[model samples]
Target: MKTKKYTLLLILASLFVGCEDYLDKIDNIEALTELDIFTDVNLAEDYLDAGYTYLITETTAKSNQPDILSGLVMSDEGYPGRYNNSVQERYQSYANGDYLFLMDLNLGVQQRDTPNLAVRYSESWKGIRVVNTFLENVDLIENADEETINGLVGQAYFLRAFYYHLLTKRHGGVIYLTENLDLNSDLARVRESYESNLENILIDLEQAIDLLPVNWTAGNIGRPTKGAAMALKSRVTLFAASPLANTNNDPQKWVDAATAASDLINYASQNGLYQLIDASDAINLDVGHGGADLFVSEPEKLNNYRKVFVGPGKSKVLPQEAIFMEVNDNTIGNGGLVPLPRTYLTSGYDIVKGNFNPMNIGATANFVEKFETKNGLAIEDDPSYNDQEPFINRDPRFYNAILYDGVPWIVTDSAPLNTSGVADLAVINENGVLGVDLHDPTSPANQLWRVRNSTGYRIRKWVPNGFFLRNCCNAEEDFYVNNMIFRMSEIYLNYAEAANEAYGPAGKAPGQSLSSLDAVNVIRNRVGMPNVNGMYTGSTSTLRERIRNERAIEFCFEAMRYDDIRRWKIAHLEENKKVEFLEMRWQGGVSAIYPTGFSFENVEQVNLKKTFIEKNYWWPIPSSELEAVPDFGQTDNW
Candidate 1:
């Protein structure tokens, strides 16, 4: 019989080694062969853990990759603060109707070594290959019990489905690779239909749900559980039922999607495994500063929403609200969504105070207007809303998520400096000078420039009260931020969307207890906001608009807006418009009612109107992949 030698080392080394010499060099490392890895349970598990590295991290944003930013700047949520060469060439060009296939051939080939969206295409395939190799050989393990084997196999299935989901969502349909194909096997394969791909993905998720535990304990907390599989299924099915994929507008698709979400909601509720963090408990805004109010209002509801992102430390319990997340330690690159601060006093720059990349992402005025008033009325509909005093009496989430001209933030500069140790406010005077200056300047600049708030607002959802850049390096502080890929709030929103589409806004699905209106109220009531207005809840079309706006507020800067717009088939209408910014002029006589004392004016962003069209709905396949398989043509009209 031929000697069976599994090339597990070759699979691991392929990530770092060159394609030309990887096979030749990896065989020399003799200890990592198939027999050695499978016989030892620890070695076998280590092979499974290697697949998890492909999961996204905070460094993806800092590296300026297109995957994370494509969801932010490419949508109406925000734009880059500095339109430098990198941002203009890669991000701006794509947003302005330049075909991605052309950009892939030009820039993607040149910067193949770096992390970009084009590179992400190849990375997902490599991850799938790694897990497929493990699943094929796991049954041969000599030292593991049935429970151990089941867990390993379940994780392998989940990882494979995750990679396929990433590819399918971005490029429409993809070739589903189930087996570990050798070099001699057939390499040219045609792409499958979107429905065919979704069926295979659901099969793997069902297997994972049956084999995995409800939740992981101690050292294995971050791994996927049965609940994670359920949550992912909810997301996947919902996307498939949207207008982009279900172009036929099938009613059964929406029903299937609603049922998937209802399954997870019922399981979680019955078991008491997940619930939204109660808003009644007040969060201390002044952590180290002696319980001062710091002029920040509505601490109870604002901080309740804030705690979902800046999670409790790893030693303590995970936030019950976070269903699944990618957790990190005290690493400097872990500030994923937190914008770079505006000045040195706030630790915006590095330790030496030289490297400064300020506010790479800024929220647009168009997105800011989506947050309704506290009475659940649009700014135009509510008589209480005052355009002159725009920031007052809005939703508590708006205060927590946006950093406008005159918001209070924690100042980290110690004593002896002028604004040290107090919660300094972000003040923009009549001349438009920001209160905080650039790192080298002694005072605020004459005008807003690079690394400053460009779109009239900076994102503050992920940046907690006491957060600072220096905390990323200080392990003693025990500061950690999680990228919440899946959370309980999102599941509720998914159900509401699908339920409203299948049944009317006030109607429930066959067996579900809550109506679509009830599902949305659960999210709003948690944040002390009022229920949806009765006027909009009478029909599906009117209530659909309200549901989309709610998602924009609840999941802003969480990277869901881009896909939401496209899946709803509204990108052509929403994306083809100029970016708007708010300019504030201080009128001087400050009062308790109008604290900022500034008059706001809307201005169109110069030379930055987005140009999305019909072909922009789905990304094109890369040239090299299509070249390899002539049968696999490009996406429609690409």
Candidate 2:
């Protein structure tokens, strides 16, 4: 344990020393030790920042690589389009109940040299150790003021909790280590119970909340705040109350979760620190409609929701809606979630080609159907829903989050158009020259079957308006967006779920005014959608399904769904099923009813069914770790 700890410290120290050459600050690189870092405030702060490296940022959360094998692809929400890629194949194996592969991939025991294995289980321990070192030695700094010391210590507590939360979510209760372990310390510690581990995490979070400021200055924007700690507490408690963790269905657990969420809500409301970004906020903005047809009603509401994901770049202040975000100057070219656009189409339009392959994270029809219609009722329940025109008058968020047939490829001020004067389209019809075909083998569009419109649908939530493949290569138009980790909307949903389970749909936790139904409607109303349907909100059981579906839609590709289904213990039902796509064909002669002259049909992807077994709910413990500590038995059924 001491040797491993020193290795991690050396790696971080090497990085710090490399930067020191440019700053000309540190005198000795080879002789620098852990104690030296603590002697100076700036060096100690830099050491603390190394812990942030392990956090799952938006770009790395799903795809450890460029545009392949994202969490969206792993979940029922999407499909891995680049089937031939080795990385995607690895993800495919893990998604198909390959437990050993999952253990190897997550633990990185055998694949440490792999590029995308950034969030391995062992890496998290390294991060925990970095912060633990900070907490142990932060008092040694001499010149730093009380406020500075407190803030740094607060960040260390928050980071330790954050890393432990990551480990707990994936591997259940791991060996909880707070102090930096030395060689003499017990090397073979027992893994604690999940509940006990969660309690420890809550203790650290409470300390973080006590020490952290309400908000940091603009210069320190991305650091955790009091609200961030509170938000994390809300998340932790919500998971603790979930069925996977609380198998006994303890109502008190739900109450605790609801109280945590409501506490944050009350604090934000009183301080005016955060609020849901209103539809009116985007009314005067000049941003383009993110591929939504020009005719889509209440475009302002759509833009409002879209803006939340495609964040305000460095030019603008962070939106009040985002309680916490991973600050990075990310563009579509590098690690951003936006799928690579079709190269041929970009070249034909005289736009600079984007990166290597036309790979995409294709949205599954299973996920598309989860969205309720404009009236806030499921399509099967909504009598006005048009089966043939499935995309119309649905949830405004659907338009903002998904790109189906007939949606514009890009909505620029002077968008390139085909010879017919129509804007370039993401059509998946049977047109050999213009549209794509899922079945036709000889079609020219099938050359790279994994292009933007491959699965008949592409994710639009993270892809901002007026975004082009050219933006990746053009510095002038480079689109920089921040990844939001915690926001007000999520807190609302957390409160709603816990409140619903603790009390009834209309009931609230002790001393709280907001009901579960009210909390959900607040999210729905922001996007101009009607409130939760009366039919579904009558009881906690029924409303539980609605709130889950609301979370599925609201946080679509934000990398929440994978853990969500697992924690709810519904992965077996939702994940082990055939993946479906929208099969559309061009039928010529356009009309009011047959606009774009296309017909739609739901078709299952051939030979593709996502497999999730009972054992998959919890990831298996790494073989090496279990080998070292034989008493720490492997995860159940592995």
Candidate 3:
């Protein structure tokens, strides 16, 4: 097992994964060999620590990255940067490869060419390699006991599954690895078929389930447990056997997926993992999550929700539902990595009365409206719905997952105001201004709550305000969040999809399972919405549609939207704005200019009926990977 006490000399030797020119090779600070990193426990710990780096590194996802990649879709209207020609043209399905990574949340757009697959792919692979190394040599831990070795092994398997899951969503058919690599295999790992790759990922997950222990102790809460592994197995199986993964539109695959998802839900209560919390009483804005102390404070259940992310009252970045999370252990003394909150954790933590932020930095309105109503109906199809009442008392998951206007949310212990730059009893709004209305605590912050005839609503998903303080720093502004790679809620969603697909939605198998409706209805009831009934039985086609929308709203901003869309083969047909790359350069004057038009052609227009073909289902293989081997073929549409 890699200890946290390895020497710096050995730690520097593991960088041979990539080489450099003579000058850079001799002076490169990143160059490290296995011997350099594995010579001691600290170095060994560093080898396995790559997982933490990927999960916590905020570098690739700072500022608007999450918003652009996950939020900005065709849902919201009048969002910024949606007026350009390419975005203007492809309002439906925009997969412009040229603008790969240009993500700006406030601006409401990103260039499709702005993506950087190479760097991300490399980062993910690095974590996987570390995990592999740990799994292989964990028995060598002379310092720690056998139970410690078991725990370390479980963590490695969890990491491999988690990293592979990321790659599966990013680029389906990613190569799967099991054992630690030799020098040659690390450099030229063989790719596997999409089906084979997914199967192998599940295999890793099963092993993880057996190896992990449930209900970990203090200092180990964020680590993987048996429940986590089981939950993930359900998630991966649901995807592989779904409309997108199977692609052949097979029903049996859907059944398998549903069964897998159900397994996790079946075990939820036993694990003390997560549960719904009723907040019908917390509207006073004084009691947080309907709990004691601060009004908007996170209740125990809500705390479980926040356990995966770093925030208030939590010292070690532990999330309640985090099966496999990272540790931003600021308590780790000077040798630890925390300069300040600005760079250490970019989304500066502010503990005001407001329990959560409802800003739609990723503003996709139509997409957000996909959740089912209390009666398991959707705003888009509710028979009794008017535009104004489309979202009324729809479902409880809606509130837990997001913030809606007029819905009771949390405020601060006291209104804070900042006469100068310093915060005091008078609270400054998120806009960095003084109290806009001392008389009105419920009034929306002017910057985010701009009214369109006093009726327009935005989103507040991740922003939670309370008695919290953040120390951001540029050195590692990247915060580590325990990605919810698996959860009980997902099991329900997966069951809905796979059940409908396998049983033809009318079959009694899944419909007869009260857990199907019960699972989702539990979520709906939490939002004070009526349960979806009558339609839960018989005829799977429409029910499938309902679940699809549920996922869209439920999993938004969790980095699963694109993956879901691709699997369903619906991206092209999606009536949202197409991404464009205009090289938005300042004309050195008062305006901006398109130094170039969008780099891709045939951008799809939104709300228009055009078929997004199956070939567009998978992302194009990286050109560099193709260059690595003469035979590797890039997916079509590159």
Enumerate residue pairs that collide in model 2.
none
TM-score of each: 0.84, 0.85, 0.65
Clashes of 2: 0
Q: How accurate is candidate 3 locally (lDDT)?
A: 0.46
What does candidate 2's lDDT look like per residue over 395-450, in tens digits?
77787677655444443333333322222233334453444312234436534333
lDDT of each: 0.65, 0.67, 0.46
Per-residue lDDT tens digits for candidate 3, residues 25-68, read 33434555444444445545545655556542212342212222
lDDT by residue (133-173, candidate 1, tens digit) is 67777777998889888888889888888878877887788
Candidate 2 worst ten-residue window by lDDT: 342-351
Show model 1 residue runs off by greater than 4 Å: 1-28, 57-68, 83-85, 99-116, 280-294, 297-301, 311-316, 330-359, 411-450, 470-478, 575-577, 588-596
Locate the minimum summed-lDDT window of 10 residues in model 3. Answer: 594-603
Error of 1 at 53 (Å): 1.1
Sort by TM-score, best first.
2, 1, 3
